[model samples]
Target: MNRRLLLLVPLVSALSFAAVTRVEITERGDVLQGAAFGPAGAYERVAGKVYFAVDPKLAPNRIIADIDLAPRNAEGKVEFSADLYMLRPREAAKGNGTALVEISNRGGKGLLGMFDLAAGSSDPRAPADFGDDFLLEQGFTLVWIGWEFDVPPGPRLMHLYAPVATDNGKPITGLVRSEWEGDKRVTTISLGDRNQVAYPLADPNAPENRMYVRDTVAGERRTIARDKWTFSDATHVTMESGFEPGKIYEVVYQAKDPVLAGLGPAAVRDLASYLKFGGAETPLSDEQKTTKRALAFGVSQSGRFLRTFLYDGFNQDEKNRRVFDGVWAHVAGAGRGSFNARFAQPSRDGHPFLNVAYPVDLAPFTDDDGLLKKAAQANVVPKIFYSNGSYEYWGRSASLIHTTQDGKQDAAIARDTRIYFFAGSQHGNGSIPPRSVEAQNQASVNDYRDSMRALLVAMQAWLKDGTEPPTSEYPRIGKDQLVAASALAFPKLADLHLPRIKREAYRLDFSVEPPRVGAAFPTLVPQVDLDGNETSGIKMPEIAVPLASNTGWNLRSKTIGAPDELYSMVGSWIPFPVNRTERENRRDPRMSIEERYKSKRDYLELITAAAQKLVSRGLLLDRDVAKLRDRAAKEWEYALKLN
Candidate 1:
């Protein structure tokens, strides 16, 4: 933690549970409209925006963040505060003591809260959330906080109101870079896509407000005069010649004001602490007050937030107590959030055209190790489960989390940490529909829902009874499973283009007093087999019993940027036709569905056996055996039904 932050922790009054002055947020009782699209059962949904104030003497760290573009809060020691939005079972008895806090993804998305907990909510752009009563079934209280600074304010969108860092009464200014890429001839573009907040140009007409354009991420680059682009609005820049498709554009200019973006991690840490321990004003129920252990799960961007939260020493609260007893970082490869820096954009995912230099994938692959180390703990480090997918190994720098810094060796994961790779799966894909369109670039068959379900059970048991969960299942450098994207080759399917943008990680240095931007380190990716499937990691029955080519890297849609540079997070699923003759005509080096299995019966038999193997190994639960077999049966029915 920074020296300034250290001072606040000591002065903070002991508050365990969060004290909320609840203000109702919705007119209807159900935020997702009735029990039809919301938490099921007799459970009634009552939501309120919870407000709290933090003493600036202790909360001042978030007020003086070392970043450009932060708003001004001149007073050194006033109450720095924020609000939390929540949806819970109106009756306390409906929820178990367990609370699952969700870190909103970019655009104020509660990826896990809506997708997994609620089960049916898929639109990240909007919060028309519905679910299969997953969390309510288990009785886990759902909590969400607005950690990122730039999320636009909207109905049903999660957000935060953090103070900006200022020097005296004047706004601090610094050099900031804004990069973008588009497949269209747009008249203007904001520094951000979802949020319109633009970096104020130091001088709107300054010749130095320069722009550069490139045909490809690495292709030829040429300069465009300042007149070609102008700051049309506070943060939006308009182009005179319009942007070309499959090109990259960037502007480097002076940007003023930086917010104490570090407050994000503080909010997470403190919130968990308050909820678990007890806050002064929080209406802690008799059951809520007795809360013993708190577990946090974040998907993708939020997962990155959890990893960074631990790294920044926020895990230890104001009372020097552990905030979360366990953390599940889902699909958050080897990177930490680009949080808490000058002009920090927590949403940037290191896309080449924009946000190439954000500080990501730093150190600490394990709970007890990395660039940011934890204060010595009384108990053992938090039990962590690093849930990753094909995308992390492909482009998200996930390899850096498991392998040695040099990429030649495997970093010994702590016994407390468990890593699982959803074999033949994409970043966000769980299961595909009965029949997928080949033209849509649908992901391969990998029903990880059962695996995810089983994993959650195992995590709970492990935390409660010290039960040893399934051992780590990931590409191992010691086994020659972790390799470069260029190291593997797949079938020559016409619709699929191999991944060209292998955005690996590096040994980054953001240790400056104010921290620095841009990272260029030596990083590596995992290797795959002849089937284009990862050789190691948890192999779902579908991948182990092959029907389609499934790999982490998938090409971008034609409408997007270069189709060759693997699409963002989504993976590819190219199925083999039922006829061997059809496969032979295409000259596909791989076997067809017919050649792989004699009949639908043969495939079902194989899939059943594969599921059994996983269950015995503890990678899956016995309850999931039926679910896997049923999915296989459905797929077989679909293939044979066509005949």
Candidate 2:
């Protein structure tokens, strides 16, 4: 192994444009017990902290919300630090010359699970955790740097340690809102999203602190009696009468000392810059520094982070150099999150029935104005892939990214950009043998990760040799593939209720106690075939040759209440009857599984053929065909034995 001495030495350095001041290596260990991955050989895990000091005066730094108000050192540079972790080939020269950085999603690692098909692990140390080592075998260096400040603290989780913003050394106070929908009766809940740290309550007895509850996303808010609930602590609230299931509760309280959260994007930009362009003192040898290009991958909340990052002009470093050569933002829809505003909450995301509404899904839904304007002006526009799933169309107002502002026509895609919709899939990649919990129906089990693997390769090829990838494959208004919810022509299936309601993205005004909601933007969904499968977008083999009706919208189960509301981030899978007799007995409109295929072998063959079409079109890799067929075989068995 060509390990360097920097692992054992403390190093302090400053990049030409970035603010990375020092790197402290706290631990180093062999990955997968020193298992070798193809020609890349053995890999190791490097974990530590990365310290930064940014000059608030720089034009690039000035955009960071409250950076000027943050505490600065003697040199007038604001100081902060973040947790860092990397998985690289032991012999750096043996790896691909590109760094694949996965912005940690809520302080957790997901790249291995998404790309490598590995079981998720916050601290991946076992062989199962590495899975097939697809990423390692490809020789790409994997990197993660904590960029979220409010992520719940666990020993294995990554975190950004940022300084608070103040007004002339005095505490700055503002109204902070936290909201949640109760799944079950509960007396207490934390103020932070998923129990991460919340801003400290400024004045506990402030009469301005108010609580409101509603039954639905658009329902009227009713104030709870002031004597009914009390703040258990700065972080939690308690009610004498337990919060009812299916009700949304929101609290508005005055909080002080907001963190300069916009620095998260700067951290991402700086790390990419530092890796591509080395600093005055460096840990990597010249040969080890073979990473000439950087690619960023972020999913869900982190995906929205990338969109906001680009919109905020963080792609260009202080040196006016492009940070990432390519970026893949998966399942982000057209939304940007609360990533860069005063008193921003990075974890607060907009969803159908989950985080109802915020600054997310705001104006400039298309790329015309707010998204790419700054990047285009700076000429730092990286190749971008806005990949979403079917759920995004129904639950995330994803059509806004491709359609006109009025949803009347298709918007022109940028030359350097591509948009892909994973047909019949959910927000998160689905699982086999679909399970149901909060959703009314069986959850969608359309696995789209195999297709994602193909897209990643295509992205690399596009960057490497200028090879054009498969053209954007999303529903278009001009093609009649996208339609309004009211125009949907769904087949009547027994015991199945089609959801006619859609989540609207309303213009919000947060200047008052309760935000004044304004006119809603038009959002459309993809047209569906007879089987209730999406007609447009990249379809996996299971979607193209299926045994069930896979839909991207699922209603909340009666057990969780609000049965009329769409379950957050969930999709539904309604299996076809096993035979014609069963289909007739159930009064099903769609063809039965047995009617579609003569036998399991026939089903497998059809699955293979469907996969081959995608492989030929560069939407799926050839190696994944066998697995798709295997999964189809299981579906065949599961359908036949259905009671």
Candidate 3:
């Protein structure tokens, strides 16, 4: 038998129980033909399924929503399983002691691309998939075990197979709400969020089942005739004339058998605990018996999952040990998501022109009440980095994380936490050769992954050693860098208009259908300079050099149903005219690109200075400066070509 396989023998008695009951290794092989990566040496991929069993009566598992309602095993424990994919050093001792765990975003891996500057791939195997071998070269073991129950099923996609909750051998029923907003008209739509598996309608003709449509996010919901639409099946609704484009549609119906969606967080907590504090039957080689620490990275949906996970108190393991030592939630904004509630839809997220009012964007936004209160109480608060982008400020109420509930002042941040705002960027990385889709302006393309890479290193340093990460960098009301959306003073450049409206967070009461929207928590955006670039936060070379205005908010296109509404998670990039004459002809208020820079070489020089400034502050890596210099040259050409 292989030496590594022999190490799986249990060290404890078989009667003993652990949160991670079994780990089934379905596939194991060398990665990239055993390509060596720095001191970490060759990497190996381990893909499999992990089975979990948690005693519902235990404090850690008891906190899970609907845990008591879930069916129990013969041992009086709830059982679940999840897909697992991990990358580790072939030789156990060669790896970094930290296990970097990425809570899969929508069932696929993202950190490889986010930090390594590589292309997206679900099953990373090829040379390009490793993406410059950034994580491997750092000697960190990469781990991903599915924690979301509703991720769309496909090959290479990670998922959680959680059992449905029941009420004493009978199915539990609750109201499930599904919402959708799209640019193209469609005759049919799934009852799930973003087309994941939907909870089947309990009674198609139930009097409580209702459908509503609205042109804008806050517009009055007009009821659609019950006869106008019908449940095509358990998972879909069919409209005879087709749902209108750019309009919001919602359906609320009775759904039976709520999956113990809360178990998703438990799945993460258990797996991380196993890696850091393993039981008898283990997966690690003898040389790598237990990981010293575990760090978590989650983006967008998964990012919000981390916030919710902390808020819900899943960081404490079954044995009351802390799960993650450090957590980096990127672009999650200030939302906690419907991850652990009754009939929760893990895929639903809040946006300006998309999913409007869900359980997301709730009250107790800042650490004073919601986010870290439970963790602080349990003394399990992990070193946290809440990183957001410009889009999150405008679309996700990200300011709520650091600002007062009223958004009037900056709240004191916890000593263990850091919040960073990526100025003049979007939800994810901006697209290159920026193009407008359904938005009114060209989409933002200011890549901030370079800064994100530096933050990951900073997180590890803070976790492993006592090295303090960079101070929090975000716009503050006290500094006059953050202001009300209505108070924005953007220059009127050619074909560019700041969004008239933005997404706002409200105190929502979900006891009633359609939710009772209470007093709104104030939201603010970063103030802009005379050139229309954001004034505060980490300004990447693109923002600091000023070839164009990159804004967090973009209005919907006129062709769409709501022209004045802010497009969901999209930012605007309006390039300046090439020369003074072109600027004069367009009557643009912003300075011309030629007038701003003496030449392309001068522009590149300024870009370098901007990158170096961030590196000095630990907001950017010195190694990324050269790559930013090369990208600036191409952007310079693209700016001039617009003329």
Arranged by lDDT with the best first, the candidates are 2, 3, 1
- Estimate, for each residue in 216-329, the C-alpha lDDT of model 3 and write its tens digit: 766799999999999999989999989988788999898888888898899899888877776555444432374689998899989999998998899999888888999888
Winner of 1 and 2 under TM-score:
2
lDDT of 3: 0.85
lDDT of 2 by residue, 1-643 (tens): 2444654442234332358877788888888788899998998888888888888898888889988789989999999889988898887788877899998899999999999898999888988888878899988889999899999879779899998999999999999998888689999988888767898899879988999999888889999988999999988899978988898999999988899998889888888888888754555543236788899999989999989988889998988888999988899887889998888988888877777867788778666755888888888999999999988888888999988788898988888899999999988877767875677788988999889999988998898888999999999888789999987777788878788676788889988856888888899998998888889999898899988888889998899888888888889888988889988998988898878988888888888999999999999888888988888787677766764
Q: Estimate each model's TM-score.
A: 0.84, 0.97, 0.97
Worst 10 residues of 1 by lDDT: 7-16
Cα-based lDDT at residue 398, candidate 2: 94
Which parts of model 3 are misplaced by more than 4 Å?
A: 3-17, 280-284, 287-290
lDDT of 1 by residue, 141-225 (tens): 6666667767766665655666767776587776666667665668787766436355465566554466777766556558887
Decreasing TM-score order of the candidates: 2, 3, 1
Task: State the lDDT at 640 in candidate 3.
Answer: 79
lDDT values for all models = 0.63, 0.86, 0.85
What TM-score does candidate 3 get on C-alpha atoms? 0.97
235: Cα error in model 2, Å: 1.0
